[model samples]
Target: MPDTAASKRFTVPIGPQHPALKEPGHFEFTVDGEIVTNAYVRLGYAHRGIEKAAESRNWVQNLYLLERVCGICSHIHGFAYSLAVERLANIEAPPRAQAIRVIVAELERIHSHLLWMGVSAHEAGFDTLFMYSWRDRETIMDVLEGLTGNRVNYSANVLGGVKFDVTPTQADIIRKGLTFLEERTKHYLDVIMHDTMFLQRTRGIGVMTRSQAEVMGALGPTARASNVQRDLRVEAPYAAYKDFPVQMVLDTRGDLEARFEVRINELFESYRLINQILDNLPEGELNVRVPRRIPAGEMIVRLEAPRGEVFYFIKSNGTDKLERLKVRTPTICNMTSVVRLSVGHQLADVPMILAGIDPCFSCNDRTVQIRQADGGAQPNGLSSLMSWEELRQYAIRKYEAR
Candidate 1:
């Protein structure tokens, strides 16, 4: 329930329970008539303590846990973690393993983007687009299951390499699926670009200038829509991306329509890349043996997830368990853009604006670290950590004062 005590202007609060938001997040939009004058957002309701949980699990065990970080892009989560661990162990996945990883990653990208498009369309009240897109998405889902024996997690990536391989039969199935999806995706692109009804909801809506995107730290398609070339695949190639490079899809309009264009065009790119990997898969062992005890050191893995850059920081203490692990997901970085962009838009447009970023609330809900303004080191060079009890009390005081 919203507080009864109020200010001069009306404030509309949406979620931690709302029809528009599928996940838990709270937003207060201060509107004057139909125009939003200010906006505020609060996340973290879906925090799963995955990072803290990773500290207790062994290196191989954490692979499963971390992949659950975001179901939509689960393969990328495991891919990033395995890459970071391989660096720490001073080993690399075999060339064929790397190529297989890329194929699976691209397949996941197809799944994620299609899922996001359906959700975004639903947010816009376009049930037709939502339904059709989701129906086509099952094609990719089926291909993934046929290849890896799972629809969502896939669990394809292990420590040194992947656990699965692409057989000739699986390759034929994937090619057929891609052929169907490519045609459907092309139709989606045409619809978003020329549909009169859809344009009213997306074109020029939530327009963020190029400078604004750069200043606000937009990532993935959000930044790329603003013509910010921030794809890690092209900038810092990894895995099979080093062998089979991708052309970063970009758009300069910096609006909802541009985002749709950039992502749909990216689907075509993913399709091309997947076919390339399957045709030129290298021959080698899937995985290699690694010692149970990893050397004491720290490493960071940055990968271009379906959603921009997914960052991972790992600290191994020469044991099976990790000492410290931190993940800064793309949604957190893009959340700032959502709030600032919502201001001055219509009240009804907020949902579309929020969905434009394809947020994964749970994935972004990591532990928060409070630092000094100067970003200087604390005493003993270790930053202070906020406890749950202290944070609860702080929230109480803040609300009571408000």
Candidate 2:
């Protein structure tokens, strides 16, 4: 029964355009006086039919296409996609290639997490922390550029193995960069944690209890903030992760500050992993030649992206063009918890609350459609699929017609 004593609430909408979020998304809040009673999120503003697009491209071409899914997670997508193809084609990359993949993955993690920390700080009106974190991020980017040809979308992965190889000289530069980032991150943490103003703004804001986090299926640092030890690298190791062990990080507070802390700590962990991979560099052929005719098979590969666990499923019909490619991004899992976290917070807290997930809207905005018997065309734009209720109705109709 509804509680009669509870006060009535007013609705407030936050962004498809706001200073807080870098991506386009919308949120609605039910407010009672100054406190939010409940919140709802609407996404899909940047969907571009990437999976469908992949089907049109051949396996080799899709490697570059998948890397563009999210700039920050470019390497992980390529890694997972290439791993799937490698499994299908029965090809094994050389040990040196595997180690180089590890180094690239960790460098991408450092860049991504540092970028998030800066954006989160900016959301909370802490400009100094934001500037410092972004400045530190360039070190990792430079290191990546020194190894891979490109800085943002490092098209390093090929069908059977990696395209870019790290030499001894490049390895030394990477090591120096990691050392610099490690020291800079320590100073960054001091500013974010000890600074009274930063803590006062972020602490206890956008709290999501452990149970709530689990029910909502939060992933990555967002779930880690709730004390859930669910790192895919540690739980279901793949690629170089199978060789190198990783310690999962967790905290029980489940607040904005907690999420911030986990990501900051992850940066240090990434630095350590990079150094370990570089010190024990393996020597072998970087790539193996794969046969033209791949066996007809389906495979699923999961990797730990900077944000959380990313899943990729690929099916091939013994042809260059894939039969199907499916991806489950971390942002999709964490969006559910975003609504819960936004409740009971002020309007000003909305941006910080959303930023707590360190969301990737482009990854979350994906939509795939098959033909329907409703005598209408499927919608293609991001905003059209933003409504969850509408998506549910579309799914029900699609199933019922079948």
TM-scores of all predicted structures: 0.89, 0.87
Q: Write the per-residue lDDT of candidate 2 for residues 10-114, one digit (tens) a residue.
A: 787777875355788888888887788888878777887898988888888888889989888899899999889999988888888888888888889888889
13-127: candidate 1 lDDT, tens digit per residue:
9898742548889999998889998988888787888999899889999999988988788899999999999999999889999999999999998899999999999998899
Instruction: Estimate the Cα RMSD of every predicted model relative to the unseen true structure.
Output: 10.1, 9.0
Tell me, by TM-score, which candidate is best. Answer: 1
lDDT, residue 312, candidate 1: 95
**Which TM-score value belongs to model 2?**
0.87
Residue 45 lDDT, candidate 1, scale 0-100: 84
lDDT score for residue 167 of model 1:
89
Residue 330 local lDDT, model 1: 95
Estimate the lDDT of model 1. 0.90
For model 1, name the residue pairs that clash: none
What lDDT score belongs to each candidate, Candidate 1 first? 0.90, 0.83
Pairs clashing within candidate 2? none
